[model samples]
Target chain A: MPKLFRKVREIRNFLRSFRCSNDNSNSIGFVPTMGYLHKGHRELIRRSKLQNDLTVVSIYVNPLQFGPGEDYETYPRDLERDLTVCEEEGVDVVFAPTDDEMYPEKPTIKIEIPGLTDVLEGAYRPGHFSGVATVVLKLFNIIQPDRAYFGEKDFQQLKVVQRLVKDLSIPIEIVPVPTVREEDGLAASSRNTYLKEEERQAATVIYRSLLLAQKLFSSGTRNAKDIKEAVLRALLSEKLVSKVDYVEIVDEEFRIRDDQVMEGDRLLVALRVGKVRLIDNWRFGDEAV
Target chain B: MPKLFRKVREIRNFLRSFRCSNDNSNSIGFVPTMGYLHKGHRELIRRSKLQNDLTVVSIYVNPLQFGPGEDYETYPRDLERDLTVCEEEGVDVVFAPTDDEMYPEKPTIKIEIPGLTDVLEGAYRPGHFSGVATVVLKLFNIIQPDRAYFGEKDFQQLKVVQRLVKDLSIPIEIVPVPTVREEDGLAASSRNTYLKEEERQAATVIYRSLLLAQKLFSSGTRNAKDIKEAVLRALLSEKLVSKVDYVEIVDEEFRIRDDQVMEGDRLLVALRVGKVRLIDNWRFGDEAV
Candidate 1:
């Protein structure tokens, strides 16, 4: 690993300097995170290393993307531990910029996806994906990565990023990796650490609901409304799963499907376990019986 | 000009084909425009040719950026004349792609700017800048120009593009060339052709109001409200100027300014000269004065 000690200005300066440098073979892969390193993040970075010549990981908990009363401050962060993980993962550079550094002045401009952001997670978290799109785009530019990796745990987010890249013509490839899960099939997430002992056990309902939908789909249940009801019932039965935000069965492009799920459709589910929201998804035809 | 005849498969295919061609010395400067070519567009291409080793001009009337009942269909187009202009301007490539070629599938994603876009033209034509930002970004990615030229006639749009490049970290340099105007102080625009002979004369008020603000500012008038009122009165007095949309003095960054005028601030004004809407602006302490 090539260690680079940098502040915000230093990172930007380094990027400018590298643009003119004759190191053409140096391919940089980037993984941007909101601090609080988790196993899911590690998998993203690990995959990045295997593909690129150098890897850069950015940890920034962006405030713009957070709506009023959302967890902007108490979102959980540990830079010291995160640095340790990046070092172990063979990360060439670790960018941990301050809020002021990331946003030198008030952001007068923002990027938004219209219809896509109005559904699924977007509906629940209003300007959430817009915030995500803005920060991720900023990181993409600052890091200037050849390839960026995103996990499918945030399926809607992956879709938003895909649209952003396509619409903006951003010159980077977005690689969507499989969602990492815990032993009981609960999707691994940084927020998962927020769950209490009992809440942790209840969090498994998210995956359980997805599994229920998958089983039904395999058993010739093609009606989206019926499958959605079955999944909702499974989540409603869990004691610790306080609220179900949404249970959607949509096509690959995230459009709501009613009757039949074609070959590449996905069944996505999001539920709240003790105030912590967890999301998980699985493709219809790809799951084993 | 090495003209190659092949329809592009996708944005990626176009970029790959351009990159594979072994011509490293030539730097490409791009000027993107709607189909109807005018003297203003020709000027942009001329400047592009002088500044870059190769010039590329793309004629795409992007529909995603136009709102319903906003003259998207009635927008003027003359491909043969546009080609003649390109050939005259020494343009190395002319990317005249069909709508289906550009958007093989419907775009699920869009680009939008918040507070900045919510006011002025954005208020009048909702989702206008979002459409502009989306299409401009796409063009930027497809062309991959070293420098992109935009006229200052669309002052808000120039600001939005600057913000997009800054926020997104796009590598291309955004160069804002001066607005091209006619002999009668009317800013040159393709839409000018839509105006009747009398409406064309009345359109001069758009620039006249901007000039009035400049005169007031230069004659030791420091109050923003007084300057705006003068400009508004000037536009309302014109028989052909149907409606005065807005007349305000803002700081360089498009922020509303109420106090004494700074040296580098701008006075942006817009109005409807008959059925055609026109906008113009002047910067304090600039050579255009």
Candidate 2:
């Protein structure tokens, strides 16, 4: 069973002791999550376990990342289930802290990557990337892991984290695991629980639309406008998709591709299916044109 | 002779090797400076050497902290003198990277502490504290020092750095050393070089005004207004003081004290003598009142 730590100091103490006694345990791998663990989290955990001697998974639905009217209150959480998953996956430790514990008082410090944070999901949700960067940096400092895992599902988030580490000269290696998906096409996410039975079926459109764009790209549609238009049209075609938030084509750096979509450029989309917002992305190079 | 590393990667590599070879060298203390070492920096270096097994002194004038028309271009520099000081003081390593090295690209990542950064030095020098926090954090990550020393002469900067570490949960201890002064009471500063002959003499009024406030506090004066007024009066009365920027009373956490001044409250002042700006602070508890 993995040892659980609720307080920051206790975990530091535990890691210190663990380091002191285990000379052979030179590397530690960390996976930060927001609980309600699924195969996506399991993949991250597996990647971490394979790479390092000890693995720590933090289950925290960071309130900082949620904007005023967003899903801070209603974000799905299941600690018991998350803990069981960690135990079953042969994890070494788990850090699960309360809101008050994570934020003893109002946090004054903020971290932001300006241009990258001002587009796409960031444009839709103000202060979201800053909050994510702040909390991720905090967790990285607290855990001091040799390597940390972040899924490519949050392509923008992954890019922001990478920028934070590079700009700050942080020593940890950031490993981006492939996004895990259900047998159908919807991306594995804790928020998937919020979808109704039919909405869940509708949610598959997010991935299907990405495939549509990929098929178009593979068949010689390199103009970003055409690919984005095609993806947006497919997402809006789904009746249960209450609103289509954004359909954008961008390179690995999150720079929006306005005219042309080259190899490795990604088609990312976000839309709401009956009040639940789902997002998915497809890389251009994945399929030959 | 102390080892010199002009690159971030080299210093990090040196530290990694130092840590591996030295079993008892558990603590690494750091003092970050901007070259042209003075008594203030010497005191900080001394404190680090006394407390830790190894000492790393970084001397880089961060361009990010200087605003438009501020002293980024003309900031004092004497690498030969600084290296001699480090050598004489027995510093273990010196990390002094160039602008191109420290910031290879346009730094998009910005760190800000809202309330504290929106006042005083932060107010006058826009984006100053954010720049300071960003570079300081970058240095902390690169060096991974156990404790970092900062002088109280830069009271607001010291507070901002402390907040950065506390809020981010960076494992380094922020050691605050007392403000060092010249025989006549002017705070030791690299910017002092900017002051002309008479301007240097006039600069003493900054510390003297702090003493005036302390004398009043010692004489049972408890109103922040009275203290600020007295300090401001002293600063403005000096003929060479071209501009009196600010004279305000704030507590340790930087909350502005409007009415009553209590124990541990600080009287922080900033003013320009000639083309040079100087800042000084005095804590109330240091005196009987």
Candidate 3:
């Protein structure tokens, strides 16, 4: 069974004690998540376990990442179930800190990644990426893991982390895991539980639009405008998806790829299914030009 | 003699190899500076040598911290002299990377500490503190020193770093060494080299103003306005001094202390003598409030 830590102070001390122990060869893998564990989270933990001698998972629904009128208060969290899943998955440690513990003082330092952060979700929710970057940095400092795992479901976030680590010269490997999806093609999210019966089924449109864009790109449509238009059309076709937040076809770096869809370009879609917002993305094109 | 490493990759590897050595109890103390070593910098190195098993110093004039018209190009640098000083001080390693080594990619992330950073030097030079914070954090990550030394001569910078380490939970102790001054009370600074003979002699007014403020507060005067007015009079009395940039009384944290003078509150003064700018500060009142 994995040991659970509630306080940042305790967990930090525990990690430090282990670090100071003569075992210099031990490699720690970290998986940061907001609770309500599902099959997707399990895959991340399983990957961490396979790659490192010790695996640490942090489950804290960070309040800083949510803007005003966002679903921060309504975010799902179940510690008991999360602990059970961690134990069953053979996780080494689970560091879950309270909001007060995580943020003892209002963090004055705002980590703003200008061009990369200000698009897509950043446009829809201002100051969101900064919050994510700040908290993730704080967590990274505390854990000091050998290799940290982040799922590409949050494609923009993964890219931001990659840029931050490289730009700052942080000596840790950032391992990107492919997005984990449900059998129905809907990207598994804690918010997916927020959907009502009919809304749950309609949420698949978010994934469908991304897949459709990828299919278009695979079928020899190089223009980003056409791919994005096709994605918007498919998403809006679902009546239960009340709104299309964004349908962007950008290169790996999140810059707008309007001229042509080259290799490793991404097709991203975000939509509102009833009251719940869903997001999904897929990479298109080959490695070569 | 301390070994000199000019590449980020080589220095990081050297540090990591030392970190993994069987002597797990060894503590590293770091003092980061932009070259052109002086008495103030030597004091920081001396303190680091006394405290840790190994002491590392980084000498790189960060371009990111300088404004458009600022003196980045004219910044004094004598690596041979700097190496001699490091050897005299018994330094362990010197990490001196070029501009390209420090900033390979244009950093998109701006680490801005809003309320704390927007005043003082920040007001005079926009984006200066953000650049300082960013580079300092990068150096701290690269060194991973157990304790870091910072001189209180750059008082605002010391406070910002303290906040960054605390807020980010960086597990390194920040030791603030008292400001080293010349026999004439002029604060030791690299910019001091910019002053002509007459300007150098006249620049004592900056230090004099701070002393006068301390005298008034020490003599039982409590009004901030009175303290500031007296400081301004003293600074302007020197004919060679060109302009008074700022003469203000602030608390330890750099916030305006408008009311009664209290213990540990700082009186800060900045002025231009010929083409060179000088700054100095004096703490008023006893340690106890």
Q: For candidate 1, lDDT tens digit of each residue in B145-236?
A: 77999998888888888888877666678888888889888878888899999898788877777777777778899888888888889889
The reply for model 1, stretches above 4 Å from the true place, is A2-28, A223-226, A258-264, A286-289, B1-28, B42-54, B196-202, B222-226, B236-238, B256-265, B272-274, B284-289
**Where does the lowest 10-residue lDDT sum fall in candidate 3 chain B?**
B280-289
lDDT of 3 by residue, A68-151 (tens): 999999999999999899999999899999878888888877887888888899889898988898888899999999899988
Best by lDDT: 2
Candidate 3 chain B TM? 0.96
What does the i-RMS of model 2 come to? 2.1
Per-residue lDDT for A1-289 in model 1, tens only? 4355446557766654454344334567888888798888899999999998778899888997888987787789888888888888888888887777677765656555666788888898888887888788778767767899999888888998888887666778899988887788878788888899999988877777787788887888888889889988999898877888888878876788888776678888878887887788888876632
Clashing pairs in 2: none
Error of 3 at A201 (Å): 0.4
TM-score of each: 0.85, 0.96, 0.96
What proportion of the real contacts between chains A and B does each prediction keep? 0.63, 0.82, 0.74
Q: Which pairs clash (backbone N, Cα, C closer than 3 Å) in model 1?
A: none
